[model samples]
Target: MSKKEKFEELLKRLQEISEQLESEDLGLDKAVKLYEEGIKLSKLCHQKLEAAELKINELKSDVTAK
Candidate 1:
């Protein structure tokens, strides 16, 4: 998948995790596992955003250099 698609999928999963974590029906073990997964996904999303920001900055610099 493209970075954007991957990011979107991760974000959607994170939202689902959030909803699951909010539920009283969730067992403690499962909740902890979901929270861990969510943290990893959150880091990935941040990395993707940082990479995109860097790319945009590079493009802007190139345009100004011409």
Candidate 2:
């Protein structure tokens, strides 16, 4: 999958994780696993945001150069 597609999928996973975390009856082990997944998702989201920022900067430069 492309970086963009992966990023979108990660976002959906993050939302699922969030919903799972919100449930009051989650077991400790499952909660820990979900927390770890959430951390991974957060990192991926940050990386995607940075990549998008870089792309926007590149586009701005290209527009200015034209």
Model 1, CA-based lDDT: 0.82
Which residue window of length 10 is worst by lDDT in model 2? Answer: 53-62
Judged by TM-score, which candidate is best?
A: 1
TM-score for each model: 0.71, 0.67
- On residues 16-52, what C-alpha lDDT tens digit does candidate 1 reach at each position? 9999999999999999999999999899888777767
Deviation of model 2 at 4, angstroms: 7.7
Question: Which residue window of length 10 is worst by lDDT in model 1?
Answer: 53-62
Q: Write the per-residue lDDT of candidate 2 for residues 1-66, one digit (tens) a residue.
A: 336457778889999999999899999999999999899889978877776643333333556666
RMSD of each: 6.5, 6.4
In candidate 2 the C-alpha lDDT for residue 66 amounts to 62
Error of 2 at 21 (Å): 0.8
Cα miss at 45, model 2 (Å)?
1.0
lDDT per prediction? 0.82, 0.82
